[model samples]
Target: MALDRWIALVFVTFCCAYGYLAFATMDQLLPPFMQRNPVWPSTFPKVLAILGVIVGLVVLFGLEKPDSQSEPSATDINYRRLHEYKLGQALMLLGLMALYALSLRPMGFLLSTTVFLMAGSAILGERRWVIMFAVSAVAAGSVWYLVQQVLGIFLRPLPFFLGG
Candidate 1:
């Protein structure tokens, strides 16, 4: 199968699974207030899953084949190679995001987000440590301050040993 087809298949499978889990566990996952809200907690996940499946199906079956005259040229090949490189980078970033999600409660939003930002910048080929750290720290701190202070939103408590 082509890489695009494979990507579509993976997207469909992931979305379906995510949607199912979200639907099945909505009561447990959502706060009581959110569950009682008009929009409903499972709506977004269900919509995302449906859209993902629709897009996947279209990608798999709807695209028109290129004519012989439109065959890939040298420039197209180079662009495709570059795209593949970027795709690999994107996958790595996704893995890092998953790791950050898993670590968030234990590490706290400030620490986990800071690390995630710093590591993500490095993975995307940023070489200057000072600028990277500064940007990451500022972004993380700003988000933390906004969410916790301005918005009065509560985050998961840091581990007991960390003075949460």
Candidate 2:
């Protein structure tokens, strides 16, 4: 849909900004010794930003063009549903995301992400406590394992007291 193209464009903008920040700010923060390494701390964020830009570009231009003579088709989204937007929930989610970012290093990936996921789900109206906890734990732990162990990215998966 054309709306998707707009979203992709916005995504591309965000990626470009993030990449620029990684290049301009993050790289300079590393000490000379660490900067000399093949993979500096900024490397991952830059790579991710590049990948995001590529994906956004693909989404932006890969769609079929609508014929000029044809009427609007079912592919178009029903913007009328915009009335269902919940401002309070969105603001709460944004605040939660900010808190998660702040807590990531101090609390470690496993605990921070698990709590974030659980609280996010509850904010979005999930009521099953057991299921929510299980899903949150699995999702966060799996991501932590993949990023830290499999990818060798060195995330702190547990608290400092637990020797993460």
The global C-alpha lDDT for each of the candidates, from Candidate 1 onward, is: 0.79, 0.87
Tens digits of lDDT, candidate 1, 1-164: 65667777888888889878867877587777786787876788878878878888887773644556555554433434665556878899999999999999888887888889999999999999999999998998888788888999987545546876
Cα lDDT tens digits, model 2, 1-164, are 55678889999999999999988998766877896699888889999999999999987885455447365466555565555668789999999999999998889899999999999999999999999999999999899889888999999888888888
Q: After superposing candidate 2, which stretches have Cα over 4 Å from the reference?
A: 1-84
Model 2, residue pairs in steric clash = none
- Please report the candidate that would top lDDT against the real structure: 2
- CA shift at 12, candidate 1, in angstroms? 3.5
For each predicted model, how many residue pairs clash, with residues at least 3 apart or on different chains? 0, 0
